[model samples]
Every structure is written in C-alpha cells, then in structure tokens.
Target: MTKALLKYTGEVEWTPPAIYKSSCKIDVLYFPFDQQSCNMRFGSWTYNGFQVDLKHMNQKPGSNIVPVGINLSEFYLSVEWDIIRVPAIRNEEYYPCCKEPFSDIVFNLTMRRKTLFYTVNLIIPCVGITFLTVLVYYLPADSGEKVSLCSSILVSLTVFFLLLAEIIPPTSLAVPLLGKYILFTMIIVSLSICVTVGVLNIHFRGPSTHTMGPCMRKIFLHIMPKILFMRRPPYNPGDILYREDTDGDGYIDGDYSIDSCGDIKDGSKDCLNYDCSNFKSGLHDDEHRGRASVADADNVIPRQLTPEILSAFEGVRFIAQHIKDADKDNEIVEDWKYVSMVLDRFFLCVFTAACVLGTCGIIFQAPSLYDNTAPIDIQMTRITQYGISSPPTVAPRL
Candidate 1:
C-alpha cells in the first residue's frame, strides 16, 4: 500500500541545490522573437521506480506550476534576449519496467531581442546609407564620380552584409528581420549602381563617340525633361542660326547670296563690303558670264593696285577655313553636354523610386517587438504554456 502522511502540514517546504544538464537545440525562426526550451530532468540515478519520487517543490493543490525567482532585467544577458522561465513536467523513459514518473522541469526562455543595438548599429546606418544613394542622381555627371560613388557605396553595402553574416548565425529556416532588411537595401543599392553606370554612359557620349539617334534625341533632349521638371542649360542661339553645315555637304555653306553679276551680298547684314571680282578674275577672268568684253575693257584702262587690298584677298581662303574648323569642334562639345543633361534627368526619377520602395519594404516587414499589452511575467507564462502543448500534440503524429 502507498503511504500517505497522516500528520502532513498544509504548508509544504523543501529546498535543495542541484545541477541540471540541458539538451536544447535552438530554433531561431522569427529570430528576435525566438523562444528556447531547455529540459532539466530530476531523479536519483540509482533509485528505480518506487524507491525515489521527484515532486515539484513549488506546485500547489488544485493549481498548475508557476515558475518564479526569475528577474530578466537582473540577468547579465539582458542586453540580448528578454529572458523568461516556464516550468513543466514529463517522465523519463529509459526503462520500460520503471513505475515511478520522473520530474521534468523545462525552463522555457521566451525572448524578444533588444532592438536598440540593432536599431542604432544596423538599421539606422543602413537606412542612412541607402538614402544617400539618391544623391548620386543629383551629382553633376561632369564631376566624373557619379558611377564611381555608386559603385563604392554598393561595395560598402556588400561589406556591411558580410559583417552582418559574421555577427548572426547562419540559418535557412528564417533570416533575421533586420538582416533581411539590410539585404533588401543592399540589392536596391546595387540597382542604383547599375543605373548610375547607364547614366554615366549617356553623360560621356559625344558626337565623336556616338551620334544621338533621332528617337533618343526626341525623348531625352526634347520630351522627358519637361515631365521630370528638369532645368535645361541655356540654349546657345548661335548653334542654330549660324550652323556651319546645315546641309550634308562636306564644305561650309556661305551665309550669302550671289547676284546676277556674281557679286556676293550679305543679306543678313544688309551690307556688301567686298567683292569676289578679284577672286573671280584670278580664277576665271574674261570667261565669267558674258564678261569677256568687260574684262577686255578693264585691260585697256590701267588702274593703280595697292599692297593692302591685294594682301587681304591673298589670305581670304585661309581665314575662312580656320573659322569653319573652330565652329565645328565647338558644336560637338555642346551636343555632348546637352545629351548628358537629358540622361541625368531620366535616371534621377528611376533611382529615387527605387530607394523609397526598398526602404519601405524592408522596414515594414518586421513585427512590432515592443508591445505594451503583456507584462514580463505574463509573456513568460504564455510562451511556456504554449510550448508545453507542442510535445503532447506532436507525439501522436510521430
């Protein structure tokens, strides 16, 4: 017959120091919200079945066990996990014939990672660096660092991700929310670098390097700037009015008209300061138009010639060729500058949208860790109670 104490006091008291070993495999899904259950089995090693009975010291009649003596704030690990304790029971199953049940106390530590460390060290810095990516669009393409800056930042983010990997344990179940956020931001930053490369390619193009196709010119130079509210550089009036080669001709066209007598007149200036007669006489002479008799008449009259007029006409062709070459070179440089502005405006719109969306997506996915609804004690109790149900429910399935 089992013994029952006849003179048992309603108040039960027992205390003892013991060492407990834990065989806990940590599950880190929902990392910062992760909970761990460490098992502590209490029993006498030699005493089998009826010889030893392990009882819960803190259990009360008509009520379940409530873990106490845990002050999470006092624990040295407060900087990391928000600790909690949950007490549970189960029998050890080493021998089939053993009749006594072993006391199983489970210390279920329900943890919520303290976010201030990650927030300050990882979140804020990553966000700040991501926001800085927008500035790459604002940088002057001519400064020659827009692509270089974006590349450096992309590499910096990669290094940051590598540093983060070293800090957090590798897991395939779920990535830490903060780490995921950093990774998402890194991808967007990489995309920014790609966009910058494209912008730089457009910025560096010139008439010598690449001719702006008509479609590209219409969209980038003409249409897109207004939609993006970009300010264009002031147009140089001389570029359109005095084009050196409006036609596809290899030679510069004279900005003048020749009269019936073959005399050149500057219609724009409403002036005729020089005649091409000396040039004509030197090249064609009496055969020009029907001026054979006129040239014969001029030969009969002797006229005094001066070194000044003759010298001016002698260098006329050289001076004209020099001016045309200078204008053509200037035109190519201006075309490149205009094309760069168009491309800059286009990429500014693209990169800004990417930055905003990436930041929002990364930050919004993290669950709120700092909820005020539950007290520390209640949180611990709830988590432990929840874990206790898992073994019974899952065992039948197994």
Candidate 2:
C-alpha cells in the first residue's frame, strides 16, 4: 500500500513492485528495418471478474469511459530500438470451469529497430563489394588478376553472411531482404568469373590457331567498337614493310616484285620474268650478249657465272617473302585482341546496370523503411484509481 487512509474511512491503496521475464516471437522478413509488437498481459488468475474486476487506473477526469495506457515518465530510452507506441486494452474471457468471466489488461509494446548500426556495418559494405564485380570487366584482361579479385569478393560476401546468420534467427521460414541481396550479388560475381575466362580466351587467340570469320569481324571490329566508343591507333604500312641492304651493294638486296604469273621481277629491262623454267635461257641470252661485246672489242669471252648469281638472288627473295607473311599474321592477331577489348567494355556497362538496379530493387521492398512518423506519447498520471474507496479519500502516492 502506497498510502494509508483514516482508520474509519474504510479505504486502502496498494502498490506492488515486481519484475517480469518473457520471450516474444520475432518476424525477421524485414530484418534491420523490422518492427515488433510484444503483448504483456496483467491480471489476477485466482479471482473472476465478478469478485475481483480489473480496471484501467489512468482515465480521463470525471469519466470512467476512456482508458489511457501505461505511463512512460520514467521509461529509459534504448539505443537500438525506438518505442513506437504502448496501447493497452481490457479483455474478458469465460472458462469452462468458471461461471464468471476473467478480465486482464493487455499492453502492446510496439518498437521499431534503429537502422544506423546495420546500415554502416553490414549493408554499405555489402553494396560496395557487390559493385566491385562490375569493375572486374574494366580491368585489363592481360593483367591476370580478374579471377583473383572475384574470388576475394566472393569470400568477403560469405563472411558477411556468416556474421548476419549469427545476428538474426536461424528460422527457414523466409529469407531476409539483406540475405536476398547478398545471394544475388554472389551469383553476379560467379557469372563475372565466367565472363572473365571467356574474355581471356578471346584475348589470347592467334591467327594460326583460330580463324575469324567475316561475320565475327564485322560485329566485334566494326559494329561493337563503334557502340563502345573504342578506337584503334592509326595504321602505318611502313612499320611492317621490311627494307634492308644486307650485301651493302648499290641496289637493295631483296628488291624484287611478284607479277601475275608468280614470277619474280628483278629490276632489269631484259629479265622481265625470273621463273626457274626460263632461268637458263635468260642467263644464256645475257652471256651471249656479253661474249659478242667482248669478241667485238678484244676477242675475249666473258666468264659463265650467271647461274650462281641467279641462285643467290632467289635465296634473298625467299627471305623477304617470309618477312612479309609474318607481318600480315601479326596484324590478324592484333585484330583478335581488339575484339576482346570491345567485349570487356560491353560487359562493364551491363554488370554496372545490373548491380545498381538489383541493389535498389531488393532493398526498397521493406515496408517500414519508408515510415517517417514519430513515436507516440502515452500520458501518465501521478495517482491511479483501481476501485471504489469509502469516504472518497484520495491516494497520496501511486
């Protein structure tokens, strides 16, 4: 009893201090943004409503019609939870063993979770790591680090999931919003690894190993490069064309041209076609002209050395042809590499869009994330009227 009335007033007041320990079922579909309502029932179990009726002490002045909920004047605030409201209602139930009804007061304590801790520690880091998947395509394929980065990001996400598992309940009823987002990100990272492998394969292709068809060349080289805004350096023919005077003679060592009949043309007026079938005939003609000039001048025949000189010229032409073929092969290999670069740029754009849309779409699905209302205030009274008091004496303390 908080206060005692006069001896003859026939009135009394009671106040009891007690502690309660209870558990409430939790719904974690929204996780960090979830709100929970826990109901606490208070009533006397031994007495029925007819003998010991329960009444709400905090009511409006001069009226027993409106019932005000519990007081919060001494309620301590929590850092992680915000008290949304505390509404109390009176209920009466009849049991088979009792004729009268049993009345009880149910206080519903509704609270909203504060998201600052989760946003900084879990959500932001997950989002940042998920976005890194798109940048894997931006990295150069030749660097050889794309797969390593993807693996590391996958591991990090798994760690975050474990941490989250420890924090939330392990019920398999429904996956949380954050869990869905993490799983989606892991799938994206795994897909990125597959894409990186393909890009590397395309980058390392050679002309001898793989032949690029016209359709592929048109799409990867002509069309896709334009869409991706990729441009190759200007072509220079002089860079690939080899020119060297190996013998240090007045003329270039391998300065020969191939005609339509596959004949090597050495710069001379008479020897227009240097085919092996007509080599002896052309050499004999040159020797005959030389002998005639020598006979006409000093009766001396020129030495027959034309066959050896022609064989030496053929060797030089063969080396020059090999060099030219190598240059063409290098150009083809460069085209394949450029095609790989275009694909990388294309995937970069695609993964970036997917990451952004997936993050926004999954996170905003929570209903309470958009709530901006303030916590409701419950009025408190210094004194409470539980039952009738004789002589109309008021309680000094409650």
Q: Which candidate tops TM-score?
A: 2
TM-scores, all models, native as reference:
0.60, 0.71
| Candidate 2 lDDT tens digits, 125-190 | 999999989889988888999989999999999999899999888889889888888999999999
Candidate 1 residue lDDT tens string, 1-398: 33333325443233343334556666654444444555544556677535554445544565444454332321233456554444444344456556654433433445455667767877778888887787887888778887788787778788778877886777776777667766777777777777777766765666566776789778766787788776677644232333233364433234443331222122222121344445345435444565444335434222322566445534543454455556566666666666666666666677677778876765665454444424354333322422432222111100
Instruction: Give me the candidate number with maximum lDDT.
Output: 2
CA error at residue 244 for candidate 2, angstroms = 8.8
Model 2 spans with C-alpha error above 4 angstroms: 1-16, 44-52, 59-68, 93-102, 234-313, 376-398
Show the lowest summed lDDT stretch of 10 residues, model 1.
Answer: 389-398
In candidate 2, position 31 carries an lDDT of 88
Residue 184 lDDT, candidate 1, scale 0-100 = 73
Report how far residue 186 has shifted in candidate 2, in Å. 1.4
lDDT of 2 at 134: 86
**Candidates in order: C-alpha RMSD to true structure:** 10.9, 10.0
